[model samples]
Target chain A: MFYAWPFATLLGRVLQPSSVVDTLTSPGIGRVIWFTCWQALVSTALTMAIGFAPAYVVARYRFRGRRAALAIITVPFMLPTVVVGAAFLALLPERWHGTAAAVVVAHVFFNVAVVVRLVGAMWAVLPTDLTAVARTLGASPARVLRHVVLPLLRPALYAAASVVFIFTFTSFGAVKLLGGPSHPTIEVEIARRATQLGDIDAAAVLSIAQLIVLAVVVWWSARWQRRSEHTFAAGRTTRRPRTRSERRVVAVVMATTVAAMVAPIAMMVARSFRTSSGWSLTPWRTLGANEVRPGISLGVDPLGSLAVSLRYAALATAISIVFGGLAALTIASARRHGRLLDTGLLLPLGTSAVTIGLGMLITFDTAPFDWRSAWWLPPIGHALVAIPFVVRSLLPTLRSISADQRLAAVTLGASPLRAWWEVEVRRLPGPLLSAAGFAAAISLGEFGATTFLTRSGRDSMPIAIDRLLGRAGAVPHAQAFALATMLFVLTAAVVAIADRQEVVDARRA
Target chain B: MLDVRDVSLSFGGPPVLQRAALQVPTGDVVALLGPSGAGKSSLLRVIAGLLVPDSGSVWLDGSDVTHVPPHQRRIGLMFQNEQLFPHLDVAANIGFGLRMQRTDRATIASTVEELLAVVGLHGFGPRRVTHLSGGEAKRVALARALAPRPAVLLLDEPLTGLDRELHDRLALDLAGILRATATTAVLVTHDHDEAATIADRTVVLGADMT
Candidate 1:
């Protein structure tokens, strides 16, 4: 209901067939669509290149520092795109700030985690014996990789690439902040047309096009993900690097990964601390009492923005848990229609956040149900967007548990409820906690949906940072950096707890 | 007495068990012997109330429990895979059923310790089930199944996966433990020697037997 009706209400404007033709024929429209696709394609390729070695290492070889490397890669992916754009805005050459290269670079930085986590999950359980068997049959190492490894990895690779493409395709906050006017994405264009130009006709057409593109990508990726889903063994052994050269390779790969992933974050934090005059904590100190006009009045401060974000994150997490948990259980229990139910529940995942926000604006404000101005609307949007991810992540773990486990508990004299608690819920602490972290973190960093819903004086951190950057002064820009750092720290802390819980789970095993 | 009568079940395919029947008096161990497709495990499942037969009545002591859920049946089962709870240590794993009964902490702890001793793993209480070796894991599973002191225990393929020496030793130890506790139980296995080692009466399940 959060997705389909509201989205359909907005897209139903497409009944004006003239608008579809006129919008497509409109000047600069083709450029927006072209930029969206091409940049996403390029960003997906770069992310794969940067993420492959780390994904492979995390999958095949076990080590102490790989956890740290994984953490570094993962944190960026969960970060809000606006903050990523802010980080590069702080780190890159000033001239590159509004260039196409800036958007691509930030996209790569933001999405390396997706490629790593998706591809790594599949690789960890991939049977190594097949490659060894090929070698025993006299296939060369390169040949083994080409024939045995790549073929096995294809499903995972396709799944990861398509996901990265969708994220980069729906690029909103980053493209808005970094893409500038010249390198506009369809999302930025829709935001501009609807909010700035009052061009709902054009915006509706663009939303339809984006929805079609995303539907195809989501469908394609789901197929590959299904093909890749066979790998969750009860447990599989991934060996620590044993030989001298192998150990060295692991060390080198880890060090480089950590350095590369951590640099932009370090730069952002350092920029937050320093100034034209010298290093100081003035920006942080002034965060609770800052103004857009510098000395005129106090305005969008980091403390208020942090509180706003935390509240939203907390609300979103709670909402997603109830809705997403029930959805997963419902899907898991459906004997014959589980796949169909899962696809239907995951409907919101196929639409970009901006589309949801825009749809809400279109659908909820007028006529029959005019509750668009409700305070719960934005958090609800975040929850709807997050629910699909929570369901997807929970289902595999839920399904991996055999019916025998629950029956084992039951025949041990546990009540059916007690059996479920003992076998199903107890085993799910890791996946559940991680999914919660994703919900909270995704809400904390969510910009596209929140941006459209932004109101002055109560701006979220992402909104505050975006507005602060639009101002022309050291203090405003410094405050933007300060808030971005706080956003990063908040997001990272949440994910760290979830990440460590995963390791703790393995330790128990 | 634990009695199964006219127990028939199929999982959407060829019949796994057809009108199978068995009876075990209190404190008597029965070993079910069958060929691979003769439904020895399926029969164990039916008796334990994990599976409801298409047509059957299960009697515990006197009353028919054909439609009773597994937990209400007061029956215990040690799975073929030794489905030990991976999250729990050896002690907690053994005490899970007692905890479900809302047994007091001290009694649960004492019972867990006693069962650990009975299984010949005196200090294994704190060790995670996942950390235990194969033979140790089997002992833990047995200890766990027996901890609740069910009216009857159903063990499926107790020593099937162990090496020959381990299998022989475990079978002997298993028989000793069953007799020591006077535990009423049904064990399913294909090996006739294992049946001879463990059961007072061996029941062969096949087309020729009921």
Candidate 2:
């Protein structure tokens, strides 16, 4: 009901007479779309350039703080795009704050970790000896990398690039906040048409257009990722850099990536501390206290928003783990229908949150199925976004498990489901916990959908931060920064735990 | 011809290879035999330019190639696990070295076909390496290593995991292939009988080699 009902209503509404034809003929919709595509392409290219070097260094050579470096770089990926927007707005110069360049930079910052994790995982398992063998066969180091390593890494590269492209293309929160009024993307325009302008028909048409484009990209990327999948036993053990040049390259890449990732976040935190007179923690201290100010009140306290965010994250994580685990298990075993379900689950990832929120509002406003007033509506939205992450994390571990173990349990008199539970799910506590942590991190920072579903006086941290920044004054701006900092710390903690669990799972495998 | 002079290496443990020295004349097949942990594979790696020895040098033909990168060394080392590129087919794996040398397509094709026949994988050019059985993969690995006709080919326990009957049969087949190619090579193995059967000459390194 949560996923299909909204999506069905969305498609039904979009298919109404003259809806698609009218939207397609509308002026500037093409420009919004064209701008979206080119900017996404630019952001994807920049993310690849920035992420590939660090990924290669981390995968190929072991260095001090290698894991820590990877963990640190991924922190930005888990932060709310609202926080990301606020950070860039604060960190960029006045002229650069609300430019297309700022939007592209924030998108790259948010999606670089996707490349690092996906490409690095594949790179790590690749047999290093293949490269050595190429070298010994008279290929130069450059030729070996180009012919041998590049060909082998092609699928993963395409997969990462496509995924990053899809993410940047469907981006909502960052572009809307950072791209400013003049630089409206399809997602931003869709939101404006739906909520601010109260034109649901136009929004439905835009949503349908966006979904069609996303379907093609998502299918292509998934196919490439599937093609790249290998069953090789992980053999390449990382070692210290063999030459001074190698050492230098590793140092430069690591230093640059860490600085780029950390600087904006550091600026955001520093902004929270600075008052009109001097540096102070007054904004943070008054996070809960509702002292009257010149700007917007937000009605809900910041601390209350933090607690609400945690509660939603916890609820979303629980939902994601259960649904994601069941979906992965079915996909791993079932033949045709399971495959369709697998693709269906990932549709939410490509679908813009604005569309989902609008779909929910239109679908569930009636008497019988009115979930619009439910406290769990936002968590459901967060869970919809988070389930994909949980599934992505758990599927590999589930597939790696042999089926004979479950069969053995079945032969010992356990029911089929019970056998699978004992053999597969019970033995995967580490992966389950890791998936849950990832889901929690994703839910904790989710902003795009939350912006629509957040009830007044019941805003999540991201919604509260967005509201505080929406108000025009020094106090509200400072409070937004403070809340963003809190989110940064919370997400960092969750990601740290998740990363350690991933490492443990990799080792165990 | 290849030479290793007084090579020493340790991974913060008791030195795996201490003052290890060996020499083989052109077209000579020499086997280095030792127990498990005697660093026979390490010695082969040091000679193959995969590992740099602590305080010694490796000479290929006549020049010192101690610091040369593995590719520039023009040497081949077949690891114990074969490590065939799973992405390529059998013929492509065999022709990889020739292609790296930038040989013409026809010549590479003919050479690969000849090597496949010699490895007894005739007409298996398009077969994926993952489908090859244990003994077949080993033979393909040998063919691949010999394709470039390196100055020295290093084999580390190539038959270690095979059954005894298959191991002995492959040892004899390998002996015939090595002699036929006239390729100077170093074979590292712990099995006495297999080494004695395959190598023209054998050098046994003691547990406490100085």
Candidate 3:
């Protein structure tokens, strides 16, 4: 409901039912879609192939430093795409930056974390005795995996595959930063049509098509997740690798999974400190200065952008928490009707980020609702996307507070509002803090939509990095890397603080 | 003969099984009687080659098979949890071992059909294993373990969770199946009556024994 006014109005204004066919069937549009499909397919296939071994190892093995290994694998996925793409650019040769291979490599790093977490958690609850039974029945280790483990894991695999496909298909920030003119995606096409070409008709048609495909993938993924979670009960404890070969396999897996993830991020942070003559922290020391290097005058200041990003993050965090908490309470209080609201709230997730960005840009710029110059406009857009995530992360904990607990308070000489305060308010700080931190982190690194909303003087950190990377010379690139590192650290610090707070609250509760 | 010699094992703490040894002559059944967590299941895994012990060797027919993989040992194990493949139907689950052995489809089908009847589920070949009752799942697990006709079979508390009437009925059926095939077997259980009913000899694995 938050974005419905803008989206419906913009669609009504720009999308003519008659011209939808003419625009969708236009020549060269097929190439945009073909590139989208093949790249998504290739990225999903590569992610699944590279991610399965590590996922299985993490799920089924008990070893020292397992949590640390998992955190290393997970950190890349948490960082903003602009940061991730900038890191890739620093790691790869400049000539390879815009090629399809670079795009696929970036997508792999971006989506691999999803595969590891999703499939690993699914495989954890699967009964290990099934594999043991198969072994005793004369099946070799490979045969047992082929016939038994694969079948059991099919649902989760499909779910993860579809999710990766959807995200890759409509991906904007990574594609915008990494994809050059030769490899254009449908998402980039929509952004171009809406912003640069003055062709709202074409943009509307493309976004609608993208929206349909995304909705379908989202629906299918939900079905697979339901089936996967429903089919099996948790059983059997995971054990440390007991044999020589088992321990060797675990060691090799650890080295590969952790090393593959940490290298690019480490290189990005380290490269920012290097100069033509020697290693210096000039970029780090001078990043906040209006003029970064002696000879260059880059208009966008990294320091100023940092302040802008923090302001927007604070506003977005406040908006999402208040609205998301109320939404979760409504959903929990009204179970039957809440299912519909639950699906509706998650619609923003299924919708393309490019489409949402365009919708906000257009709807506010027009006459009747011209809030385009307002300082909080971009944050409002950020909050629109952040609320769904907040609601999702907070729903389970909200539901865990049973109605009986509230009723028990009510029966003991407390009014209904007082009862809510006594029960939910007392237990809300942990989950609420985590949710707010998540919203803040998202706004800090949000690249896809922020790319569109950066026409204002105030630029977010991701936009600053993108503009810096686009400019030539070593200083600009160094500043981009420096800013990327700062963004990375800020996002990581927020996540770590939230995680620590939750653990502390968990112990207290 | 199936023999386990001085199998000692621990999980980085107190030993769960220490200096445990057992020998079963061909065509005879032995029961390892112990309470829960007495390491009877761990010892059975060691003999089946699913787990390697700290100090032990498993011998089958005068050949050391301790370091061999479980698939090559020809020792069938029916898990206490009856870990039936939820994805496979009854006949496919029963025929899994034969398929692994590369038996012809005709032979696999005949063996699966006959074994389903032996376990009193003759018409259950097409049914999903996930829908089976607890007792039925155990019967299918037993049938699947027996389908390849292992030289020796291991049952790990196979009837522990079933109700009294079903347990008694399944015990009789299990004993009849074992004797009729003349299968060399070892069964582990915490129930004294179950141990007496299913084996020719009973050995104790207690805390003090470990």
Per residue, candidate 1 scores C-alpha lDDT tens digits across A228-315 of 5432123364787745777887888778877777888888888887766788887777888855444786456667888888888899
Which docking category, incorrect, acceptable, medium or high, applies to candidate 2?
A: medium
Q: In angstroms, how far off is A208's CA in candidate 2?
A: 2.2
Candidate 2, fnat value? 0.69
Q: A-chain TM-score per prediction? A: 0.89, 0.91, 0.95
Rank by lDDT, descending?
Answer: 3, 2, 1
Cα miss at A447, model 2 (Å)? 1.9
Per-candidate DockQ values are 0.01, 0.49, 0.73
Query: True interface contacts reproduced by each model, as a fraction?
Result: 0.00, 0.69, 0.78
Question: All models: lDDT?
Answer: 0.82, 0.84, 0.86
Worst 10 residues of 2 chain A by lDDT: A291-300
Off by over 4 Å in 3: A13-18, A225-230, A292-296, A505-509, B35-37, B206-210
Q: Higher TM-score: candidate 1 or 2?
A: 2
Error of 3 at B153 (Å): 0.4
Q: Return the lDDT, model 1, position A428.
A: 78
lDDT of 3 at A22: 76
Lowest summed lDDT window (length 10), candidate 3 chain B: B201-210
Q: Arrange candidates by DockQ, highest first: which order?
A: 3, 2, 1
With candidate 3 superimposed using the best TM-score fit, by how many Å does residue A99's alpha carbon deviate from the native? 1.0
Better-scoring candidate (TM-score), 2 or 3 = 3
